[model samples]
Target: MRSAITLEPVVVTAPMQTSPLRVVLDPKRPYQPVPASDGADFLKSIPGFDTIRKGGSNGDPVFRGMVGSRLNILVDGGQIGGGCPSRMDPPTAYIAPELFDKVTLIKGPETVTWGPGNSAGTVLFDRTFTRYEKPSWSFIGSLLGGTRGRFDQTADIRAGTPDFYMGVSANHTRADDYEDGSGHRVHSSYERWNTDVTLGWTPGKDTRVELTAGRGNGHAAYAFSGMDGVQFLRQSLALHFVQENLSETFTKLDVRAYYNSVDHVMDNYTLRRPDPDSAMPMAMASEPARQTRGGRVAGTFDWGDAVELVAGIDGSGNTHTSRSGGPEGSIMGYYRDMPRRRDATISTVGGFSQLTWYLNTHQRLIGGTRVDWAHVRGYALTGDGDSGSLSMGSGMGMGGSAPETTAASRSATLPSGFLRYEHDLADTHATLYAGIGHVERFPDYWEMFGGHVASTVTSFQSLRPERTTQLDVGVQYQTQRTQAWVSAYAGVVNDYILIHYLDGNGAASNVNARIMGGEAGVVRAIGSHWKGNATVAYAWGQNQTEHRPLPQLPPLDVKLGLVYDAGRWSAGALWRVDSAQHRIAIGEGNIVGDDLGPTGGFGVFSVNGSMRLSQEFTLSAGVDNLFDKTYAESVNAISKELQGYTGAIRINEPGRTFWAKLEVKL
Candidate 1:
């Protein structure tokens, strides 16, 4: 037999689109700007993706200028919801990208295979399970160290027989406050850890049964908020079953069920001392929690080589509760002893069907439809008499006279669907596609219950479901030496939820809006040992009702990269630039935060390299912001007047930094 051969994968600088409106990423490969600490940080390397920077980690992710529930995020086909009312911990906060095998991103409302209301897009972080031919074992591990006391460790080990398998993975990361280019320290520090275990049984070549459990906890300091995230605890459990090649027509069946919960605590004492002049000057803490349970079942059917169909039903429900206490060493100082108050309960059930018809080898048509029933019941603290004013501690960030108890409930039937056509140019190695999609999204907990209403004391009964109708068009081209893709979308939002902040108080209202954006990228080989790549992304939005520009939209951004590969080692450099944003809606924005004002543009450069030490080990290192440039992203959180932080209105990015990593496989 001939000797086995293998090829090393190149270090990824910018993710290239695999198809129209879709991008696939390899989580195991080394990337520039050091290894990521969380999923949001890793996603930022891709075009058209940005984060609401609040600190060193746990920043909320934004896609195409949209944040919050508009973008659906999933891990192992399961959903995890954060418990912070202020959105300090987004769904991506609990995700450690290094522990997964693959990351798939589908932009726009192009499919209904996942859950409902993904108007922005869908992200799936998946793990692949393999069956052994005989008794076998595998191991993969990594260690990382960086500036400002940054350190990370990860390990994955698996051993299995032909019929049985077991695996476990864990990671830990921490960092201290980082200084800006001017040598001023920002109040940003964090620590996090997570562990997961899996067990599986493979009775036959075409069947699989698996169970998984995970737990994680962490804490992060914030410069934009009055209180820091002192505790973030997560617990999850899931079951999966799959059967393939059942029959000629019944190709496959897949089923999944999961449960997830988040217990979060925020305080001014755990991470830092209370600012003497700030609100709530004494030690205080609030504990908020959420529990989510859901499941999905789908079947795939194929008819010869002409057509295929997939049908599925999915549903999920969740509840939110909170308790608070303040002033250490005094009566009622411990929040743990306070009785938890149930505030909101929400649920959704949906059914979907998707089909693909191969008109010919070069042309195809794809379509899908889904309908969802959503409901919500909110408990509000109401004042006496006819004023209808809410009381303090109502979880609406409002204060009023002593209140009476009240409840409100709302329900809606939503419909969504999409249709697309694709044509492959014969012998040209290119494909062109166009599609249109529509989605109706219900208001989330933060939009309906976290703030006051425009005309009422509360928003629970006044907000309306948002509807989006969009058209997407794109093209893909690939050759022996180059790859390129471009995609664009335009949509109209009816009854769009908008948050307004005035005089330190927040209110929610409905308005009509229009949004448009596009992203393009190209990668080309220059010679035997060199390569070049570039990407650009931009988004624009307007509040049609008021004829003003939408708030919190990211500015035009661009990235350029160059690399040189020698047989055993490689080096790369990246330069990122952003254009100044003058559009402003001031007090109006999303749930995370509102725009401060116009932001000046800036650029930064970084470099990285890697070398194979041996067959089992490899080392990589990089320096970010090599020039120590101090700049803030246009979509960053507004900074508060903290005791020690004297930065600009927005939280600034870290100064010049360095990181190194070591990997081993066995």
Candidate 2:
């Protein structure tokens, strides 16, 4: 007779923290609400994370109320930048989470092993390759279908031997316009696809060399802007070399280099008809592109068994170019033939060293420091007789003024560091930690070249570096049947870059601000067959200079889930609520959009289930917004008037949705 075995229920609502201030998620697992179509969609399932929804896809992610460059995103140890001046495509827009093996998030400035300027946090999407002792092959794939014509397919295949290995990953996703709870259709449709290839060579058990290449493209319709993203194209390449067991004290040596590029296009007529009464009454389109290249070399060392160290040097550079055409029927594709003009360039070089010291059996210390030198140069043309002056009142055009070419440049040297102490309970499975970190951030492309200064003709020469000092504290506990964690942070920002929108133009300025936030979660086993979990996140900010609430902050949000597991199948329910946000800074926000006004509170309910059909196959399905409630996020963009659609000041979420997914491994 054969014996019967039971399997633990899979997490479907939200992932739990594995350690203090750190969360590691398996990208291959199925999640609630809906299967992710992009990186931002996957992040929304975590506490202390939100998205600035623009459409069905390509939304920018915000962590702890910080957006843009404050949140650093790395894919396979490389950085990629978007090209759109209006932020139609963020760094996350180029990432397809399903292709990665693991996603790790480090909340707050707790560590600085990666690059600089990560004031809010750091997120890494990584892929791991195992050495094959003999000839072997593996395959993993999934197919998903849902309401509103949503369909997706993904596949990963690998074959390897002791000395050589190769693997390929690819995915495609598409969705049609979805209706809101009010039975009105929103202009939110999109299609995207990506493919990546990896090759590795292993000469011995301690040495390895690998190379990766990828390409992706997509199009999305937006309900919050006048133009739609007609194209989001990306290309990437990276190489890595690693050697272990070099000597007794020198543990390892690692080196990496990467190149990434993004080419984007936006048009008013491709995805939707141009509003007859809007600013651009005729057909219009713009194309912008950026190229980024960087490299890093680091070594790991151990001093006996008490201390360990990692030191490295890294550098990167990027250039931006754009072109536009419109207002004339005879020049429909003029942008395609026009030459791309380079408007801005940025470069940076930095060196860092981090160490871990084991003081005792129950206590430890960690710290690191880094210094970076940054340079930026911007080009503009104007008729005001002011050399190195540019007008960003409208689009990338010259504002119908005579062209007089000019340029300006600036440089800065900044320093950053962090220290943390951790204590492990001697009698219990728990850990408590406290950390303090400081970072100095150079203004990015948007703050320097995409906006204007209130007091000067350009912001490139006037904007100053931003400095942040923050403290983070957290506790984590785990047992066989229960897991719990809580984390909090408070920070002060000097020369905080604040963007103001007026008369359809954006202006940038510096100010002082204070920010505080926290997140907590717990998962407990009620019985052999039942489990319960809950999580809460909240953030608040104040503009010290203006003595008022900061704009674009997310409200208090909570999530509750219950699951029942029977040997071969499992079912779960999830309830989410968001508190009303009364704080307002009407016209102040980030690069994507400005806040319109206050928002009311709302709640949503969803249910999900999964079944193992066989040893190699699993199926899952879910229904979101069970009550068909109409709601919008507090940190959302203002809606733009379309030709035939009427919407509120902010874009609303989708109505009741149904989806299902199937997976197989061999």
Candidate 3:
């Protein structure tokens, strides 16, 4: 094993960013969110990042050109479930921005540094303890408000010395129905809260021990779903130890163990008051919850001169359970969770290692692989042992294990690998790089129970793993007044997972689609105080065999922005235009939302400003959907409509609004 070495990208990773604002969700940079919605919602402000729109919150982001299980999302090293089955409660929604220190995103399948099947790269939201050269204290806070009675508040405080440290943080967020371009009020409302605490000890110069505990809960209304104000509750605890500056031969060492539990509830009992004509048929409720508890141990080593290696293992099992007796219109006891709640603890274990070598001053290479082993056990749910939704195909508490099909009574092994090469230009600040990768992902819970077909990757197999073989290449350049990057990739996927659906005959159908495309972006600093960023991307994938455009392939799009940063103040403007997308299928979807519906091209504009008030305090604010454009990112459900669109395409965006943030360091 070698010592741990620093590996950081020169520029920040964003979703085909056509704006100067970097992706705040990326773990490498520190981002403070004052908005009161789930974390992923904040990401939509970036270019090339869109969602399966249903009018309101809980929209799952599609980055670059990948979505669903293709993207690996983790928080404080924990894998949290996205509460909304249609992804209204994306994993980021379950996390509070005030709880963590930084967010990181690695775009594309250029590396295999994270866990299993992240063919779309990895996203990590991390937390780090505060350290002081001497005894010190600090506070960070933010407030936000917008149209439709929207508002949010957050606060974090930390105090400590080199020998001992402690910190705490919390937040509250709420919103009401909003009107789209058509002046139609949307029922997108939610309320959430979070709190965290950590105590640390620095016994000597290079060692530290820490203990952590926290709890969070919230409820939200969805225009895309039939229910409202679904409840979200969670509690978690963790223990960690760290040792740095060990020796030149062993640069750094770290170990962490954690246990977390979530008690989520979804019901119309809170927001849906009995209104005869308001689409209320009695009531809908579900208290289903998914609980996942696990622990991990990892280490990093750096080999002197030219090599660095990282290896570690993690294991965790999750289970789902619920009980409900309600009206036919009510999906009571139907708590939406990752991998539909069955009476079983699906367990997974995996290990990984990566080695980077400096072949020469002009070249480098990274090679690594990861293997995951999982055991899934579940039984059918027969409605209090009396009658059941078996006829509805929703019973998940009775079926026995498929021993012969699974590797270990209910388990299987997954593996992925990657390789890369790079070179720097002579007498210039530029680099050219390319790589090839092979990645595989075991079917996710949504891809299983949520899927109407027997298999997504195979003809009849039950959710066979999705595999992708990709080739990636790109270039970057920087000058005193200009910066630019152009990335292009092409890959042929085997068993490419595609979706299918129908609504009358003209409703678009995504037959067997194979997808392939590329993205490009650039920013030039104009003369003295002006900076401009622009990007254009086009992707097309389809059931190559079916000869149809891939369902939901991002349409031809363009983004442009201008920024002026000077001393303690920065101001910027953002504008985006997207071509209409007619390609779509009604059903094939991941847990959150699905398919393409009819859409017309539209444009949106926004403005933002930030200022450093003092050495210790900084303030920032921005207005999203500046022009209050009305558009549907994509359909949440083709067979139905969220709130109302006459048909199924729900094209609703927020009206003109304002948001603000404040940060303090002491």
TM-score of each: 0.96, 0.96, 0.84
Candidate 2 lDDT tens digits, 282-397: 67888889999998899999998899999999888999998887634535456677688888889999999999999988888999999999998877633233322222222344
lDDT value for model 1: 0.84
Steric collisions counted per model: 0, 0, 33
Off by over 4 Å in 3: 1-36, 83-86, 245-248, 274-280, 326-341, 381-409, 451-461, 499-513, 566-568, 616-619, 635-641
Error (Å) of candidate 2 at residue 227 is 0.9
lDDT of 2: 0.85
Indicate the TM-score of model 3.
0.84
Order the candidate numbers by lDDT, best to worst.
2, 1, 3
Candidate 2 residue 651 C-alpha distance from true site, Å: 0.9
Instruction: Report lDDT per candidate.
Output: 0.84, 0.85, 0.61
Candidate 3, residues 224-302, lDDT tens digits: the string is 6555545677777878887877877566676767766666555545675544443334454445556767666666677
TM-score of 1: 0.96
